[model samples]
Target: MAWVQFGHAKCGSREPTSNARACRLEPRKSMSLDRFGHSTPTCEAWTMLQSMRRHSQSFLIYVLFGMLIVVFVFMFGLPSTDSCDPQTQIIVAEAGNFEINDSDVKSGTMRTFGDTLRGGDKEFKAAQRQVLYNMVTTLLVAEKAEDAGFRVSDDELRQYIVDWEKGNPDQLRYISGGKFDKERYKNFLDYYGLPTERYEAYKRRELLARNYLTMLETSLVVSQVEVRDLFEKRMNRTDLEFIKLEPMHVEHLFEAPTAAEVNAFLAEHMDEVKAAFTANKSEYSTPAKVHLKEIIVQKNDKMLRQIGTETDKAKAPDTRFKILKKAVIDNSMAFDEAAEKYNEALVYRANGGDRGTEELENLSKQHRDALGDKKVGEIVAFETDLTYNVVRIEEKLDATETPLDKVQSDIASTLIKAERADKKMDEVANSIFERVKNGEEFAAALEAVLYAETPAEVPPVDAVDPTVVPDDANPADEPKKAEEEAPQRVKVDVAETGPFSLRGASYGSWSRLPMIGDAPELARAALTLTEASPLAPKVYTVEGSRVIAKLKKADTGTDEQFAGQKERLIQTIRQQKSAALLGDWRSVITLSHPEPSLQSYGPWVQALFDQAQESGQFKVNQAFLTPSGSEVAANE
Candidate 1:
């Protein structure tokens, strides 16, 4: 490459025959050839450069055209508003075709999340989050289950509902507690502010989700060992002493008073009757919490008579009634003011016609009947003894507590019962103690024993009591001949019974036991048996029953025997392990997920667990989870 000199400055040197202006640039071109392998622009390269320029121009034009279309769409065609703007939409969430409106979100109601959780605390947001999570999770899980072909069948659902109804006998209380019989269900939904269908849908989802989870868990086969182990751990595990008060006979107090005897007594107690009248005058008085305004007649004597007549009738008023009514129809003034204007001779009218605190007892039952129909500011007309009585109730107290005077009879009855109980208990205690001293068992001495005898006929093999601990032979269980088998109950006619203990119960069907309520003493005696000194019979008194318990036997087996039963023992051990796992797992699952819908438990199962949580039957166990996830139980 050659350099050109221009005004003492070094420039590319021009070629010998080349133009000087072009030569300055021509040397730069030669430098390009050093970088590549070409010196000057070629014919083929020029054509390619022109084609590249054309392609670039085409791409640019396409991009600009697309931008123009987008701009146009955004400026004129697109819906221009925020999605969450309250003014733009009536609702936010939708369940199927149903819109969740602002009205659905409790505003000023007492049941609002604000009222239930926060009150006025900043922790309200956290509380809201918890509620939202639970609600959403419930909805999502149910939805997923439905998608997976899990559904409640009509027959199964109907049976489930029947069982539910059978279970909750007191469910009618939720149905307006005996107000309107026909509208009970409707009223209940209204009280909760829920549409009936919506509530049903919610329940369906919740139940289906629960059923799905239950199906999953139960399909998990807990072995026989597990079942037996759980049974052992649970059975006879709870140690509790139940103290029960005996039911006293109250019929003894009332020896059936004759009608003639009562009449003669009433005659003799005429002064007492007068005293009773004086004592309960307040009870007789109808004291209603009535916001009262009295309206008296302000018409001619003839008109008053006509108004009085119309008030007594059940039918519509006549021309004379209309004339009298129009005379008192003061539309502009308040009812109270109208009452004052109309009332002239009435008792309340003299005092601004405001019956401040009218005793309901003072009014006749019929007049009082119409009082309920009258609102806080409306005139109700009804016939009284003297004249037409039009009254407005400012307020009403439906029914107050019974006065002390009114309940005197009840008090007298209760006192009589107490006195009878005192007298009877002394007689009962003496009778019981004397019988024991006379060498008779306490249970045998009691006239009415709750513990009944087994039928003479042999009962079913499974009908034997599971809780009854069997008696052991003092000499030891001998290996008797194959023909000589043991009898169910031991006959100890002459020989005193051996040491008593709850060694173990025979596998018997539990439905055949005598009605023995709260056998605490028997349980105590059974629990405290020993071999050294055989305990004597202890008459343990418990609720609704007495027990005569004597120790039969108490002994531990040898290791040789344990070795012989080792295989059975290991099976037992395995079962115990399985049971333990089931118990722990059930406890965990039940605590986390409980059936809140089932409020009450059956009698047999009641002893197994605490009652439904929210009812305050069982204390909250922070350490334990109840069957219903509604509460954390505090079990000691």
Candidate 2:
């Protein structure tokens, strides 16, 4: 959604062009580029570049840059102003015998960003780069297709253009009863300032590329065995959930340690408590942090619309920012109250915009500068490239160490709970196991043992009506009271690990139940379990932690499901093959461009474009590319 599409035209309709490509950065992925060099950089311009020495980085700057000047500016600075721009019609690259030019790339970028051009320079550069690459890749791959004896008939080319026009939605105006008007087509190209010959050549190149790509996709046949494997992986996996038995889970069953017992334990185990404190001493030590609340002012269309419709003031960022500053900072409103009243984004409005305590260094430079000299309860305003932050300093916390005396009880309590859990886990497990054997529901049994709610084996006879004394014998023999004992409950937590297959999981993927730790024993039990007897045959001790597992949901592959999957798997495999092929193709084309994320395994193609740049086979000027100008050294 961030990148705009030009391959598809939607008049008033939502349909895309048959060949619409959403720009992206990847090998085998598409992009536009300048065709070749028409003019060299001027001597003075060359002199300036030599002085700067700081060349541009890679096209990966798409990720580096932002709505602000972007990482592009950070890494390379602006491209020699406009002085470094190549002459018009300069050729940028060559694919087979075909030449790519500056105009093609410029036109591509224009079509991509269109009239409004919202994303500024970052999007424009990324789109331009992608379009050029796309053009080269299309031609190179199309040439290969032609060599493979793939011929484009005139009829096929015409049909491709017809499909392209249809994507425009108002295509009916150019076609009468499905017949395209040649004159109308000419007029259409003229409206876009494209010559008939150049435009047709572009369309024909695109048509050849598509046909070749489709062929490659069709050629990679998926085996039935692979399909079945995927089907089992997806459909036969078990949805298993389990809980690790911990002292806290059955805390209710443990009677609170008495003061005397606690005292005795303290005398014997004060060392353990001290050990825990030492182990987690850093947590007891406070770091330098600041507690603050903030109100965010994000620049958006609504704020502009609020200024006025179709007015000059509405288009200006400063005017909208002024209004936002007034609402968020210039007001007499309390910070907390203002957050609820004016923070337009839903995520920002919650908790009255409380950022809580954060390290002061983590604040942006602007906020840090504003808060540097400010004291508690002071407000400061700062702006990021994207949004304005109105902040209230609540407290500046200094790094402080907590005394051991302050946390002794907490340490003791934790150690005592650990002891209690160890004491109760076996008891809880054995009792629950017995109940399950006796046909009591496992869940109910677990719940009863956890919460100390196990029902009495036999209901106590109703106490003889307290007021209604028995008529038999002496009144001295009052009715004996009947009492029922309450069963001990061990509260526990149950966690579910959605679904996973045994083989796939055994191979180190999803091989363990959620919250139960990663144990092969648990994974096997989950897959083999049935709804009738969902519990594992025995309690499992995974590492030091004990757990009981149950199958939450079992999805055994049915013939009908397998039948549906086969067709889908075929389509999936074809897409995979196509992606791989395209990836390999791009890999070869840009092989010389140093990248960290490139394929070194599988098939390797000769780095055609990179080799060409080295061999003087094609022309490229990096200054115009802005970010890839490290290659500008070659021109010098």
Candidate 3:
């Protein structure tokens, strides 16, 4: 009897008694055989059993092949120690098939932190996450640029790096302590463990991203009507007639808030109080401060004589400052003692020349620059317009928040007093405003309600010369008689008492109006009035006083003036429109291609290691995870 296996070579051996060739068949061929030792035909049941045996044999072979592949992968292929290992090549984010990884994040962090990682691990991790997001976004932008056929040549990229370095020479100087040393800069990169090639690649990416943004910004077009409208709004001017009623004038009429009143007010406006506190907490807290001892020498004759040297010519006025500066630099005297001996300003000299703890923002620019980054006991000399100062930093204090408990009482009292005063002032002002609206003159209404007085006129000095002596008077008695006689008033054509011209006042110019008396709210209120309804609808508080203003006149410029500014106005409008368009484009791109989660790639790599450790598919090298002696020493 002979049998065949489906899709396989038939047995050729002549060993009929052996079972080795019992069901074998030749490759690419199939045959049917009888199962009851009959050569002619087979029964249906026997044929079915033969078919089932062939299929089972094929299924078993497929199962064994799959198992072999999985075993090979687990034993050798999956646990790769090479750079191409799936673990090492895990993708943090993908921008059009460009995979971001932990190495990329590490490079970015190194570039950003340089030699000084300011806030340690927390700052580094935060910066790394941000950098990863930025890198992914930039990569997407670069891809878009490439699709648009934009290409940056090697020479162009090199030139951009050069320009960037040139533009940031001050940053380099600061890092190198006022010297640009290539070796030192290289060492700094080494300290951060950033490779030169990786840094250059980052710079290239930045250049490409910036170019993409510029392309979008430059495509914006602004209309002529927009330009003209912006011009008119910015350049049109007005004249105002205003009456100012100060809170000081009416504050005496209001009583101070009693304890019960304060508590009641706070209870009524608890939400407002909390909101105000949240908004203005920084104002109550003191910022980082430094206490200084200073010596100021004015540019005067006395200062010049003390430190100046006489030659064939007269002594130079600046010589004294130079000498004093040299003396301080030479450490001939302590800063506090020097300030006491040389300081000309009496206010600072009383307490060992102490300037007290002052916020850096409060100091003059020169003083701030001299003291910035200075350590205690360090002396610095800097000059202002009229004075030469030598300052010594006595102490430095970090910023601290003021406890709410301490300030709560004062805040409550102030808020309650202000609220009561505002209500009282508003009632008085509203009554007067109603009268003005009902056809009473604004000046008369003010006078009736508040007894407001018109400004007194001053006689011109030229009209009554104090130096002149009358010819008919006795010389000795004439002086006394002239002094006793009232000076004759000069008739001057002054504008109506309240009428002040802000005709040339454009945007932001109202603050410069001398007639408004340092009240910005008054100036703003005056600007809002129109010729149709000259009177302001509401009274405003300015410098603790209530104010109401009328817009006497508004002069939109003539066509001739508009023609002169048309070109400049168009340029300004173009810039404004371009910025808006750029902003929109940036938003669209960022939204369309969102960044991956901000879980830093470093942590992701660590998580992979953790999973690998659990599965036993890979063994973690403890040495790689442990810091080297040098690294530990450096951290210490």
Candidate 4:
């Protein structure tokens, strides 16, 4: 037979040619011998091992394929960075060398507008146009600041943040669904594409801008005179001395009126009633009010003893514990009464342990619910820590109907006084108009008429001159009348002597000594002196009362007193000029940028204009309001 020869176990054998060869057979390299063919056993074994290796390789390949599939599912299948749809755009405005963007507008304002228009699909689009003007203005200011090379230090920014956080702990409630929630804060930042670091940076920039403006304004001088003048002009400060007429105390005038009497009064004075009502509807409208009260029974040692007694009954060893328990339960009925009568901490003791009426709003929630639908004098019970409250509904008011009746008496009284006032005013005005026209000296005529009409006497000689009186004079007897009689009246006169400066004009008019009306006329006349001018009496009449006043000893101090005000005036003048320029520029800018809107920023812009006018820092550009109602360019 033709046999394959293999050296050193190169050939596979069922029984090795040597024992060593059988132990270490080279299966991969050997050939198998069979009855039908000359094939080596090592060859078959090697083929089987190769098949097993291929299966293992296939398993690993499957695992790698699965891992790649999982990675793709986690990557593209999950939420993408761009998935949250945000319709956002940032617009910028250039102010000289620097630029500012939409983000410069306060976040609060932007969010408010957003929330207001959130329902409609086109809201965002509308908001873009509506917000553009304010955004541009804010951005321009911010950019101008940047160009000025103003920067806030990190420490300053941190301090400001701490201050803001302290002042506005409640603001966090709005930022986080009314809770101190971290996730809400994070979501808010994430939605705006801002991290904590960027948020702080923005806040610091805002603080810096505010500080810059404050520093710019405060560094300039503001005089006491300037402040006082501003206060005098803007604030309505009047020194009034009048006894209030109380109808309630003087009940004899209105004990009981027949229906016909009331009707006759109403009918005779229809115009007066209408005028009073028209001028003062507010006085006739009643305020929303509630009547509520609280009963407080505080816990103290006596109550603690009672509680201990009950506990002792429950824990009694030899005594009849069940009987003691029953007795304690029966005594519990009077626990509230005991608290009111004997408890040291009880606050209410009078009116059968009653508390007075309190406002509904002031009542606690439980108290309000307890009082629901209860009528007057209806006693209801509620529990407290140490006492049971027996509350009586003392009063209730229907919102609409109740106010009308409550204010009717006030309305009627107001109407009557107003009628008296108008008639008195007309009488006084006509008198003044006639006296001035008749060549009567205004100040002299005022004092003479005032003294003649009222029971006011000149001050006593002792009051006027303390040094002229003698301590040894008789206590009861009066001094003998002098042969020279007292002057019946005093004369007042006016003079034009003044510093005659712009600063003087700002204080209205000044006087060292001023005349007064006789006591009866004094209170009425003060209200008529709304404006100060060349010396003349200011006379006022209200409800049979008359007052007379005259300017005396005028002193308009020099502008040296307003030295500190000069710098502030200069800045205010500059701001006025800038504002004027802005107002004029707005028309042209709005026309150019028709897509955006410009709103009326009133009072704020107008205040600067008014100040400049009064301070003589502004020139009237009469051409600005032309016959054709078109604005013209102004310089100054």
My TM-score estimates for the predictions, one after another, are 0.24, 0.46, 0.41, 0.37
Candidate 3 per-residue lDDT, tens place, 319-406, comes to 6556666666785676556655656666776576798988877888888877878899888888887787878888999888877666
Sorting all predicted structures by lDDT, with the top scorer first, yields 2, 3, 1, 4
Which candidate wins on lDDT? 2
Off by over 4 Å in 2: 1-88, 115-127, 164-188, 237-372, 375-395, 398-555, 580-631
Question: Which consecutive 10 residues in model 1 have the weakest lDDT in total?
Answer: 25-34
Residues 428-451, model 1: lDDT tens digits: 445554564465654465533222
- Model 1 Cα shift for residue 422 (angstroms): 5.7
What are the lDDT scores of the predictions, listed in order? 0.39, 0.57, 0.53, 0.38
Identify the runs in model 3 with alpha carbons over 4 angstroms from their true place: 1-92, 101-122, 143-208, 219-226, 252-417, 437-441, 452-533, 541-545, 552-636
User: Against the true structure, candidate 4 has what lDDT?
Assistant: 0.38
Better of 2 and 3 by lDDT: 2
Say which prediction, candidate 1 or candidate 2, comes out ahead on lDDT.
2
lDDT of 1: 0.39
The TM-score measured for candidate 4 stands at: 0.37
Candidate 2 per-residue C-alpha lDDT over 444-506 given as tens digits, one digit per residue, 9 for 90 to 100: 877777656322332333534456656674534443322223233444666677766665553
